[model samples]
Target: MSKIDIRTVNVVQYVCPLREGGSLPAIVKADDGFLYVLKFRGAGQGKKALIAEFIGGEIARAIGLKVPELVFMNLDDSFSKTEPDEEIQDLLKFSVGLNLGLHFLSSAITYDPLVSNVDAMTASKVVILDSLISNIDRTAKNTNLLNWNNELWVIDNGASFYFHHNWKTWENHLTRTFPLIKDHVLLQKATSLEKASEDIKQTLTANKITEIVSNIPEDWLISEADSMSPTDMRNAYIEFINAKLSMIDLLVKEAEDAR
Candidate 1:
């Protein structure tokens, strides 16, 4: 696996709150002069969401999907003072450290299946990846896709890897069937799941998975009290993903049946 470098930037300005979900990610201007959609570590869902964003987005990019470049944004308390909203101010005050940032796509439009035509290959790959991660949030109501520069970009993968919330049961849940693909926005339009499965198997090698999960910061993993060390948590993620990869064929069949 090649070296995966995630750049770290300083937040220069607090633009506005996205207010899309409970996490309340915001749009901010960074020192690098690029606007980013920042996900706060202090949000209700906490660091696990950031973990999913890093791992899932990297995997999507590895498997020939276009994902927004992810970066680490350093936040300070001074930026929190500028925010007018009390709730957002509180969020910023608590998130006074490393947070996840998604490169903001200027003039990007949300993907709508009715108006946007997606090729079967891209749709199939998205469906297969979502199923493998057991993402339950990419339904038609919330596609979590953006149409930018005449291409589709997958985003907001914080909702993937649902089983991670309960570490004790994670091993038992690794091989459980992911039935959420039935509600996936691209399900009906996707074809060639077998080909997508093969491509994913080739692209996401063990080394690649290791590199992806290792990108997560140690602090985030240790934020909550747990017996596992940061390295152990990273290895656990890799193990869970490998187990999921072993069942890709079953997942593909499930998606095919749903379609």
Candidate 2:
């Protein structure tokens, strides 16, 4: 695996929780003097969610989409000491280690399909990306997309790559059609899918796939443990992604038919 250069920061303060979703992610200030949206490791989905967030962010960026900078957040016990809510306190306790943070896009608004207009190429890329990762969260009801600085920035990909949730069934997912693509907020707007598919496959080289999965923190890898070691887990992701990569044509066909 090639060396990946990702930022690491110590979370200095828990600003407030974003209660819009059940997972309860929080806004936080870090030692670097930047505010971030921190995704806790102890959330119901566990560290595999953070792994998905990290890898998904890179994948989106690689496909020419804007994703907020992702950083590894170090959370100690002190950050949770003053919390008033027991639920949050428990969340802090379980997340007392490396969490994931996205550089907060101040004043960003949710991407409402009713109002926002995305060009076909950009929309196509996002559709292909969500399909490739099997992201079920980008539906019209809860589009995990934001409009920041007049640009479409993808966020909250923790729900993608769900194959990791059950090791026994992971292999079965690689070639399957992403049925959820039809529900994607941008699916009907994605007119350039064939071009987008070629571009995505061009960008996702084997080395790039390895690099993305290889960057998963060992902590996240261990959280998925029933029997596989972290190294084994990493290899499994490489295999999974490669299989998906090899069958991009199938995924594009699904996306095209869904619209």
**Quick one: best TM-score, which candidate?**
1
Q: RMSD for each model, in Å, please?
A: 1.1, 1.7
Q: With candidate 2 superimposed using the best TM-score fit, by how many Å does residue 155's alpha carbon deviate from the native?
A: 0.3
Evaluate model 2: give its lDDT: 0.88
lDDT of 2 by residue, 31-148 (tens): 9999999999989898988988898888888778899999999999986688989999999999999999999999999999999978899999999888878898998999999998
List of clashing residue pairs for candidate 2 = none
Clashing pairs in 1: none
Lowest-scoring 10 consecutive residues by lDDT in candidate 2? 219-228
Model 2 regions more than 4 Å off: 1-4
lDDT of 1 by residue, 1-259 (tens): 4578999999999988887766899999999999999999989888899999889899999889999999999999997787788898899999999999999999999999899878888999999889877788888798899999999999999998877787777788777888878999999888878888898999989898888888898889985556667887888899988888999999999999989
TM-score of each: 0.97, 0.96
The per-residue C-alpha lDDT of model 1 at residue 15 equals 88
**What local lDDT does model 1 show for residue 56?**
87
